[model samples]
Target chain A: MIASLALLAIGLALVVVGPRLAGARWTRQAPWLAILTWQALTVAAVAAVVLAGVTLLIPITAVADDLGAILHACAVSIATAYAAPEFLPGRLLGTVLAGVVPVWLLVCAARVLIGGWRARRALHRSLDLVAEPGADSGGLVVLEAAAPAAFCVPGRTSHIVVSRGALNRLSRRELDGVLAHEAAHLNGRHNLAVALSEILLRAFPRVPLFAVAAVQTRELIELLADDAALEAVDRVSLASAIVSLAEMRAPAAALAMAQGGAALRVTRLLAPEPPMTAWRHRLGAVAALAIVAAPLFLAGYPALSAALSDLCNI
Target chain B: MRPFGELEAAIMKELWSRGEPATVRDVLASLSTSRTLAYTTVMTVMDNLHRKGQLDREMSGRAWLYRPVRSRAEHAAALLQNVLDEAGDRQEVLMHFVADLDSASVAQLRSAVEAARRQGDSAPGDAG
Candidate 1:
């Protein structure tokens, strides 16, 4: 029970503090590390909460060497815990936390994945009709729109799409930069990373951490892609391409939520900063690992100590 | 299998350019100038497109005459509209190069890029 409470407390603290930690200045300089940290924080929080419930259902006294004996002890502990009036409420809460949370998460994940897949397939079908293969644009499907636009549809057969307006507005070098940016997105499989954050946001809309992480993930991904594009094109060209593409008109409602990602990206590109030092990178990786492992260690400590004592007696 | 997609594109292009209902034989003749395709292949592709609702078919004599449900420009406009409408909501479906910025932000960013370019020109060695 004490371990379960400790785990729950850790989860709550992480939910409150994770966003602030991720929003630090260092994230812009090292987006890959930042993305890793964000993923670790989210996974740890979910694991902590779920483990808290499981630890409640299975008391430390239920620890045993064999599977059968362990199961028997867990069954007896749960039955006795429920039978006692004093423990009934805690047990009920545990049942809901352990049983309901995972199932709810799974349902939400399914909805997001299936809905995203259907939407992508439909978009691909539309592309087949209205787009033609570009002549020398590196296999990009050229759409016949006059509005400057560019995007990539990711799937087994991913396509980088650019409109005729973009072609007309951008120089050859600028267009190459844009294509490189979209290629970075597809090569890195950034879609899956974004989807994971989206799932959490959908599952718990009210949680500040999930909400903040979703927005941050989207921004970081654009930065990451820009960084990749730098390898193939000059900063000036890429920055200009970003500026040209920003001419697209969005709805008024979305303008309020827009972070002006283009501005941030262009600034970073123009005055690039040195990446994190080797030692700092190592420190960041270790911190991410610790965040994920802390909950598991907290929930398992009691059982681990009990087993150690049993071995000593033997 | 990849060529099938190209063939579908060719068939659609042929139908749209003809500006009238065309039989499978008519499409095959226009397409044969570029590459030889079996008659059954053209028929099967058109049949699939009709099933997918991209084309409408009517009986002309003994054969089905196929026409695009919408014009090429209309399809292109609808595709662009769909993309812009869903851009804000569906991040997983597509990764746009840059989200559309308001006019104010666009002006700010354009100037920023201009400044960067001026700085780069001063230091020739720094340009990639």
Candidate 2:
């Protein structure tokens, strides 16, 4: 019981402080690593909170002796939660948190997934009717809009849509930069990452950490995509393409090339980062590993102990 | 990739080519040149298009007359608009294919493009 409480407290503290500490400037230098750290933190935080509630509900005596006692207690409490609807208020809250939190989060994520899928299906169908297949050999569709816009519809039949205004406005080099950037987005499957962050944010809107994670992840993916495009185009061309497309919007269902973190991207591009020495990159890797492992170890401790004790007959 | 399926695109093309409001019979007749299509199929497609806000219809005696709400170009433009405006919270940080810049940033972009153009003109081989 004491160990569970300690783990729960540590988990809650990490959730509150992790985002603040991780949002440092160095994250920009190593976005991929930062993203991994954030994802790990989110999973650990949520799991810890739920486990805390579960541990509280299970009588201490159940886990006081060994792992077998904890499991037996957990099973009993879950059954009791369902059978005894009229329990005391404290017990009721514990029962609700332990049983309902996971289900609620799942429902929230499903709603976002299903909603995005339906909207994308409908919008893509409409896009097919109106857009002209562009002259470019690449699978680019042309829209006749005056506003300079370019975006990609990702999935099995991914297509990049560019407006006539954009086609006419962008120089050949700028257009190449934009196309490469959008391709990076599709190839990276960045939408899935954004959607996962969105699910977490939707499930817990009040939690600033989730909101921060969603926004930061969205920005990081854009940065990562830009990094991928750098191999193909000059920094100025990519930055200009992004800057020019700043005003054009696309449907939420499609990942827009110029979406999220434009200012930061432009700054990073135009004033390129001073290359990190080998030691700094190595240090970053170590930090990322530490952040990722901390939560998993803390959250998994109780479960591991229970299994080990039960097997060893201790 | 074609946004619409074969029949939907064919139906749209038929309606777009005809300047006036078309009935199911008119559209089907035009499309039957290369392949045969049932009148009911054309009617259902038109109805589906109407529901999807791609077309508008008027009552003409016993039958309904259908016409595209906008020209093909305008429809294409509107599709872009739909992509822009449909995502409710999208305005803040959603699908921005183009940058939603303030005037200052727009000026900055214009200048940058101008500079790039000048550089391209002066040193043609610089843009590798």
Candidate 3:
């Protein structure tokens, strides 16, 4: 029961404070690390909450030498825990938390995955109808639109699409920069990151951490891709390419962040900064690992201590 | 394996350029100027395109005549519109180079680019 409360507290703390820490401006300097941290925080929070429920339902006394004995103890514990009038509320809550959270997350993930698959298929069909092969050897396709836009559709048959208007507007070097950027996106499999963030946001619409994470993941992946593009093309060319392609009007709801994202990316490109130092990178990695492991540690400590005491008795 | 995508693209381009319905024999003839393809191959591709709703077909004498469902430009425009409109929902499906920005941000970024260019050009020694 104490372990369950501790785990729940840790989960709640992460839900509230993790976003503020991860959303710091310093994260922009290390987008990949930031992405990793965000993923770790999300995973930890979910695990903590689910494990809290599990610990609540199964008492520390349920710990046994064998898996079968442990299962039997857990079944007995759950039945007695539910029957006790004094613990009815906690037991009911535990059952709901453990059973509902994972099921809800899974359902949301499936919905997003199916929807994304259908949308991608439709886009591929449209591309086949309208796109022409580009001069490049890569899976580049040219769309005959007058607006300068470039995007990549990722899948087994991934395509990097550039509008004819973009070809006209961008010089050869600038085009190279844009192509490298899209290539980074495809090669990095950034789509999976975006989809995972979206799933969390959808599952917990009210959680500020997930909302911030969804936005930050989108922005950080772009920065990471820009860094990759910088290796292939000069920063000036990439910056100019971004400026040329920044003319589209985003939806009003996302205007603030979308507006900031392009300007941030362009400025970052124009005035480059060194990446995070080795120590800082290591510190961030350690922190992420600790965050992910803390919940499991809290949930297992009681049983572990009980087993250790029994061994000491022998 | 054969480049089926290239063949489909070539047939669509040929049909769109003609701006009129063409039979498989006619398509094969026009396409043969560049690369030799079997008449049956052309017929199969056109048939596939028609099935995909990219092409409309009508009976002309004993053979089927095929034409693009929409003009090339119209198709391009609609496709672009779909991509932009669906940007909000289907971002995971397509990773755009730059997210759509309002005019104000665009203007801000443009100046930043100019400033960077000036700095880069003024300092010849700088590794930009």
Instruction: Show the lowest summed lDDT stretch of 10 residues, model 3 chain A.
Output: A77-86
What are the per-residue Cα lDDT tens digits for candidate 2 across B1-128?
A: 22566688888878887878988888888889989788888888889989987789999998889998879898788777766654324312234444454555556655765676577668877653
lDDT of 3 by residue, A109-187 (tens): 9999898887777677668777899999788999999766799999878889998877887889889999999999999
Between 2 and 3, whose TM-score is larger?
Answer: 3
| TM-scores, one per candidate | 0.84, 0.78, 0.82
DockQ for each model: 0.42, 0.32, 0.40
Q: B1-128 in candidate 1: lDDT tens per residue?
A: 11126677789888988999999999999999989899999999999999988899999899999999978987786687678667767889999898877777777888888888888899899886
Off by over 4 Å in 3: A59-86, A248-258, A311-314, B1-19, B22-66
If you assessed candidate 3 against the hidden native complex, which CAPRI class would it receive?
acceptable
Consecutive 10-residue window with the lowest summed lDDT within model 1 chain A: A77-86
**Cα lDDT tens digits for candidate 3, B1-128:** 11136688788888988989999999999999999899899888899989888889999999999998878887787788778666655678998888777776677778888888888899887846
- Give one digit per residue, the lDDT tens place, for model 2 in A1-314: 44346556766786789779445877777777677767867776777667655655654333334556656655444433323223467466566656788889899888887777755665567667777888876777888888667887775666788889888978798889888888888888777877877888899899988888887887787788788888999877888787666634233223533333677787787666766567987787787567656645654565555555533343
List the candidates ranked by TM-score, beginning with the highest: 1, 3, 2
Find the candidate with the highest lDDT and give its number: 1
